[model samples]
Target: MTAGGDVGGHPVGPDVAEAAVPRPGPVRRFLLRRPGLVDAAVVTVFTGWALLLGLGADSMYWLHEVLGGPRVLLMQVTSAVLTLAGAVALVWRRRRPVLVAAVMTVLGVLSLALTGATNGFELGVALALYVVATTAPPRTLLAAAGASVLALLVGARVLPLARTVGAKSLGVDPDDADAFAAVTGSGPFGFATSPAWFAMAAPVVVLALLAVGLGTLVHARRQRVAALAEAARARAEEHAQRTRLAQASERAQIAREMHDVVAHSISVMVALGGGASAAFDWAPDRARAALDELVDTGRAALGDMRRILGVLHDDDGDGPAGDAPLEPQPGSLDLPRLVGRARTAGLAVRTSGLAVTGLDALDPALQLAVYRIVQESLTNTLRHAPVATDVEVDVRRRADAVEVVVTDRGGTAPATAGPGSRRGLVGMTERAAAFGGTVEAGPYGQGWRVRALLPWNEGDA
Candidate 1:
């Protein structure tokens, strides 16, 4: 009955403390933390893929026919240069999207004008369109998409004309005009002369739209992911702010408890020390009693301070000693020891209802509140009522609440509204209010009285 035990005798659990440190998710644990490496790896893999396709196309018979003799060598050299340059531009697309898109666009157009073939440059342009859509502003993304679509349209129209002209310039007859048309379903002016060639432009148009649409969809997905990430970051910061505020509040409460315990104990020891010194000159036996009271009061105060310190130290989940358990907090059952200390301090304190029932049914916090209220009341009586002949301590349990009333006969000392006095009253009021309780302290009849009504919800046990 001297201290509050854990209701369930349970040690501290991990549900709250362990959740503070989270395990990283799969993507986050893998490549997401290394964005630069991921980007470089993506660019390298895509560019190498395009280069392989371009080199395979170079070995085809059609390229030899369209670009024959010295012109054949010229086109191969031009293709190599454009492929390498376009690859470099694509690699830097995320950093400078607009510039990369522009470079890819020009390379696509030059390849159409000279080689008249689909190659690595065209693939680079498509990849750059994707980069633009994801990284650039909305207007810039739309413009880049439009430019890519335009290049596709122009390539379809100009490739046929370029092929005929390139063949004549290379002094090679283009695979016989009728035979080439049959194979490719196009002529020198295929868009104008051939219905099938004009129909083929439809798929090219669809392809362009599909590329732009795919890029836009990817961009939307990226935007959503970024928004979610930002929200998570904001919530984490808010939670951290709240935790800091709670820690500060807990520290302040601990300080007040320490102050009440230490201040009251010190006052009693000092009073007893003075009494012992004065009595020693007249009566040795009286002096010996006061000295013994002084020693006992000092030791009690030291024990209380140590308990308060344990509460403070254990806040960080580290106990006072690895092998030793912390002391239990004082409760309503501890009021006798508290009153005994006051009597030893030389206060004429009398008690009623020492065996109050249903005390164990109250919550530990409420029990502590009741104990502190009585302790602080007795401490104040000892400090301000030295001449008072009688002080009464009462504990009563009603149907819905537990009531504590402390009354002391009037003292010759004048009542002062000093900081320490006001602080003690405030602490008592706060403790009661925590459990939907109320406290009233004022002069009653011929002495000071403190009455506290603390709610007792037995079901809370």
Candidate 2:
């Protein structure tokens, strides 16, 4: 078979895998897909061709006929039958390449012995040798090749043919000559030129070796193609896995952003609206002022949402944005605004070291984490704790870390806001953990306190 055909189960080379190997065309691929059909065709064609060559005049085929002598019908029939058997053996050559090669070589040698020539059937042995070379181990190949070459020399009667041809040309009857069949009155190795039979058989021997070499090349190329295809599949799978991880991480970050922006903005707005409603009847101007604060709070929340959504839109080319320019997230500089919002929401918010010491010098990502932590803490207080609650936000920046502690004194009861999803605390915890930090949230003497400590990264600093 040609190199375009499949060896074992590896499809030789499809177009994509033909980086350096020759790509099999449509006809070859179709034949390769049905190896059984290909084998049957090859066997049939080989049997036909070899049998046709056997139809020549003399029963001796080439040797005696070319030397001008005897013919035998029984010997000719025997050679034909053995040639047919060798052709049929080709059907199983792929399954048992080494065994088939040995069988065909023996049959060819027998044919040469019985008919005085191979009768054009030695090609079967070469075909099997090719298959053997493709699949066998290197040592096995070397052994098989050595055995086949030796068999070829013996079958062609290398010494006998040379001697017989030389004796015939010198007017001696080769059939009556001795084993060496040397020229009349000449020593065994004294022939001046190469004999005719040996000259013809030498090319066939060389062609047999070439068959093995060609098969080796074909096998090597098929292995390379299979390896390339396998590597490509692994790379594609890895890329898909990376894509999945990136998408999951992005979704989680978006969830935290949504909770921080929407939850905090809504909680503060709810507090202002409730205050405005409570004072609407008792104090008209104060209620009007509260309503103004509520409107400002809503607008600011809208702007923050736009910015967040805009970032999403820029990244994925989707989502709503009110043309808010892409800007960095709120960091240490934005904490005062956060505390001011809580105060305006009617919480008695106080501060200690809210100013940045080395916070601005830290990683921006870490700063964002700190900001989210503080924002979530205050949002929980405004929604869960009573209004006019006394809240103390303590921020301390050290050489290696920044700590944020927001604690609120309990009021008479729960605030006007409804129960929360409690996702804010989870967001805070996740944010801190990402930056190698920690958060603690629970009841502190009948009040709620949320503490977060974020470290300064040496690389970021």
Q: Where in model 1 is the C-alpha error above 4 Å? A: 1-81, 137-142, 158-160, 163-246, 312-327, 353-355, 414-421, 442-447
lDDT of 2 by residue, 1-461 (tens): 12343334444333323443346899989988999898988788767766765556233344545645435456557767887788778888999999998888788677656655555556776788888878888789888777876785555554453334334534556567453334332353433333534543665677687888898998887887778767756554554555567668778887779889989888888888888899999998988988888888888777777776664554553445535756777888888898888887888888998666666767788878878888888888887785645888888887678888999888777676777677888888888888788999998887889988887747776
Tell how far residue 215 is off in model 1, in angstroms: 5.3
lDDT score for candidate 1 against the true structure:
0.69
- Supply candidate 2's per-residue lDDT for 154: 55
lDDT of each: 0.69, 0.72
451, model 2: CA deviation in Å? 2.1
Error of 2 at 179 (Å): 5.1
Off by over 4 Å in 2: 1-110, 135-208, 314-324, 357-362, 415-422, 457-461
Residues 1-461, candidate 1: write the lDDT tens digits: 01221113421222322333444579867876787787777567656765565445533346566446677667767767777777677668879877887887787677667666545555566677777776777798788768776775566555764445334333345657764454334545545654333433454456456656787887787777667555556555554555567678788788778878976777677667767888898988988998998888887777777666665554555555332345677887788988887776667888986578767567888878888898888878767776567899999888888899999987766643233448889899988888898999998777889999998765855
How far in Å is the alpha carbon of 134 misplaced in model 1?
Answer: 3.7
What lDDT is reached at residue 165 by model 2? 37
